[model samples]
Target: MLVRTGGPLAAVDPSEFTRTMARVPTPVTVVTTVDAAGRPWGFTASSFSSLSMDPPLVLVCPAKTASCHPAFVAADRFLVNVLSATQSDIAGRFARSGQDKFGDGDMVPSEEGLPGLAGAVARIACTLREVLDGGDHSILVGHVTSASVSGLDPLVYHDRRFTRPEPTPSLTTAG
Candidate 1:
């Protein structure tokens, strides 16, 4: 229950906040970047969205505690790969900490050398633009350099699980 005493709203419990957030379906993405030594780093992220169109920008939040966070924070560019529902296993691998994330996946390197998933439904190559504070996570803003879509249904996360997005049939006009 939330009670407003005429001042500020009561602080919501973190667990409750998490539960409430789970109700919103979000696309599953694997954001990848490399270290100074050229070692690849990646992680599964559901906290992602397009932020702008004119200048082309996107945002993704990676927890500060993520093992690959440092690599991303240091890299000047990264790739955002929206996975197809069939890649749930790949998403699971990236979501885990201290595991080999790219070993079995269809990892491919772009012309500019950024690592990305081969069969991603959508891939956005971005130049790291800005970083903002987001409490436990860091909000990374990227300037889109190039983007491509595979015309496939994307995987999504909801209620703490990954599921295929069922496409709704488009209606025809009664012409």
Candidate 2:
């Protein structure tokens, strides 16, 4: 048996930890919402995951320095657009700063009026549930109001690059 101590888990350097974890693959997504002034705002993020299925909650962590951070924090409502493999360009567009991210995209509105990319693998509309204060970023938890899924492969992020899921071989028997 190995012994383990429970005292804040040995303060590992954050930069090193982040860089190390970035090596772990994650799914890429575009979180979108409208600001109080009704302008579309969005960001490409991989720090997103499903928190709960019962109450339908999801989490998206936007860095403090993100361009759309302010608008997202204020609106408290948003949509998680699960990008398809071919949507890597769109994700990159949103990730860039100093320009209107929604300018050259075909964004349509969800039932809640949040912007949803035309063809994502999945789109989840959510209302602000809670915002937890994290050191470098705020963990925004949203209660999913509605969700939709279109049949498509998801775009993934790994090794500091975008990736696509490879098709699996069918298990059908050939006589």
Best by TM-score: 1
Q: Candidate 2 — worst ten consecutive residues by lDDT sum?
A: 102-111
Worst 10 residues of 1 by lDDT: 105-114
Instruction: After superposing candidate 1 on the true structure, give the runs of residues whose Cα lies further than 4 Å from its correct spot.
Output: 1-8, 172-175
Winning model by lDDT: 1
How many clashing pairs per prediction, in order? 0, 0
User: Residue-wise lDDT of candidate 2 within 1-175, one digit each (tens)?
Assistant: 9987776666889899879987998889999988888888999999999999899999999999987889888876899999999999999998899987877756887759888887899998899999888788989999999989999999999878999877899889889
Model 1 lDDT tens row, 103-156: 884898873588887789999999899999999999999999999899788999
TM-score of predicted structure 1: 0.91
Give every collision pair in model 2. Answer: none
Error of 2 at 95 (Å): 0.6
